[model samples]
Target: MGSTYRLQLRNQAKPTDPKHQPYRFESVLKVLNNGDEKLKSWKVFVGFRNDEYLVSASNAVLADGTSLPANVGNGTVFAGYPMTDLKTAIETAGDLNQIQVQVKLLGTQFGVKPPNVPLPETIQLANDVHLS
Candidate 1:
């Protein structure tokens, strides 16, 4: 199935001395399928260019499905947890509810300050022809 990837980063809290410590930020990774068929065991690769640490995440697991904490700075692949398949927007009777995977992530990034956005280097569906 054809799909598009979106990454949104936001730092709403104002903390003191962020440069000295990890700057807290929120990130959402979304993949919207616009193809005719649903993708089973889909995987999305998130690339990071900075030293970022992921504190927590939801509705996602490491591509290998083992690591307790998903790392960002080092770059990692995220796979849907439990809900392994990404159904088409129309497959769910146009509800569009299942389309949302709720890939909200909380993390701390070091070495980035004001005027700079903590965005991933690249976001894409890394799964090719192979299902594994």
Candidate 2:
């Protein structure tokens, strides 16, 4: 009945539990696109007790808080996709509150022209186009 927007997620490396110190992370959020072309970015209210907030491609926390080495921001902007198998990866890592997140994109960044991205033939299944 409606189109779905996919938000791809990747977890930055971080040390948590001594046993499960390293974790694999990823997420996809399917959002119901309203009539507007832009998706409103907001922190998911998963409810955890940390100063971390999703800024863009990486999650961030205020400077006064403990700085996590692996959780450093990557300066990449992204959007929210519908919660999919990605949620599983998140849950496996730990509590959502403990994870830092960032807003992937903004209004001006949304309508920009596409760069020359190389994709395989199979990858270009349908509406794919050459950027340059």
Candidate 3:
């Protein structure tokens, strides 16, 4: 048994036809649990789900028991719009060692239905929220 945290990504945006590019996002985290410290981040390949991407500081299992890689992508780039905000938050955190993450698109809404549960209405609203 060890420490575990949740990561979520939501597409809070309406589909804009043309001109507006398709949206994509990622959650980058610096985690510290007990006495161990590490930096871990995950990028959404298909960034439209409003689901939790669970992470563990020790051995943890996905709901389906799928294996996830330890390090997925390089995180050196830190500038411009969305990434700017994400970078600032990561840098300013007083406790980057132990953290949880919930990431969402800036102007969309989403919901989740667990296994065997009835799916709820799709969320559709624009909000200005800081994940801090």
Candidate 4:
């Protein structure tokens, strides 16, 4: 069976509270299965980047038969970056709008063993929001 999968970013937003510490932001990672094959497990590398440097990075995983829906799963809010670093990068680039989020599927399992499914390349998440 021909099966395909893709990663997307959702619920991207910046912190509105002034009391919030050091330029914090939040977003969700969405794993989508478009094909008919039932996935048993999968892993992906996710990160945020600007024109100059990577702001943050993390890994996500899904297991069991919980991979059937179009919205297969959701990843936790990746608070892996320091606000100072992100601010520095933004200042260096001189454009907050240049930052982008991306994800890459590392591997997948159809059953108890590895499948012939080809790993998809890294893709940029659409509708990325800029932090003020």
Candidate 5:
């Protein structure tokens, strides 16, 4: 069995006060088991970046749901950051479209065996997200 994963920017909390410089946002990461075999556990590494530098990076895990045998299931993880930093990064790079997100799946599942099996590797969720 194999799995599919995705990452996205969600749950945006903009500052109510215009004077507030830093806006806050969250990254929603999801993993979906698409094959017949049930997943034992999974982990992913995510990085948020702009053209010039990385804004934030995090590792997420799914151990509870994957403990049982099941098919066609999904898991989620969230990462958050301040908009002021992100905006500054983008501005310094001179392009709003330079914002991007990257994700990589760690090949070791908790209960899965056999080293020869292939595992999902990497995915890019967004090259540019329109921040309003």
Candidate 6:
């Protein structure tokens, strides 16, 4: 795949719970620079609806450093730590796996049902580098 993604709804024997909603889901977003030389201090925005509760995230951190259980229904932006810039295949010697970031997000909602997807409404990625 050009870009990697993971979207799944927990289908437990009893997937319904009262903590927030009966529907629980997780999404993985991998953003990269497929057409650029490199992206400096890159950040990615993932949009959603219904004001879902963000249980947790891994491999990346929110720009605001919001702790777990944050609200992400409106949308959220995050960036990879330690290695913030995304190098292109050339930079990594054709190692595509080393040129991107993978983020895992867990959340919950109540209104989304079958026939509808439980994924981000929109995803935008950009670099924060500024030219002097």
Candidate 6 regions with alpha-carbon error over 4 angstroms: 1-5, 12-21, 128-132
Best by TM-score: 6
lDDT of 2: 0.25
Candidate 5 structure quality by residue, lDDT tens digits, 56-115? 333332223332122211322222221111222323453332222223322212222223
Q: Model 3, residue 11: displacement in angstroms? A: 9.4
Per-residue lDDT tens digits for candidate 1, residues 1-132, read 433333365453445565554577777777666556777777787887677777777888887655655456878888888677778777787455565465777777776765777677777777785434
lDDT at 61, model 3: 22
Each model's TM-score, in the order given? 0.77, 0.21, 0.19, 0.24, 0.25, 0.78
Model 6 lDDT-worst window of ten: 11-20
Candidate 3, superposed: residue stretches over 4 Å from native = 1-22, 36-63, 67-132
Note the residue pairs that clash in candidate 5. 23-83
lDDT of 3 by residue, 1-132 (tens): 021223333332346534432322233322122222322332222122333222321322222234433221211111111221122224546343233223321222223222222121222111122112
Clashes of each: 0, 17, 6, 0, 1, 0
Which sequence of candidate numbers ranks them by TM-score, best first? Answer: 6, 1, 5, 4, 2, 3
Look at candidate 2 and tell me the lDDT of residue 79. 25
lDDT of each prediction vs. the true structure?
Answer: 0.69, 0.25, 0.25, 0.25, 0.27, 0.69
Task: Tell me the deviation in Å of residue 35 in model 6.
Answer: 2.8
Query: How large an RMSD does model 4 have?
Result: 19.9
Q: Tens digits of per-residue lDDT for model 2 on 11-125?
A: 3235444433332323222222222222233222221112223332333222223333322222221223322112222344533332222323211111112232111111110
The alpha-carbon lDDT assigned to residue 8 of candidate 4 equals 33
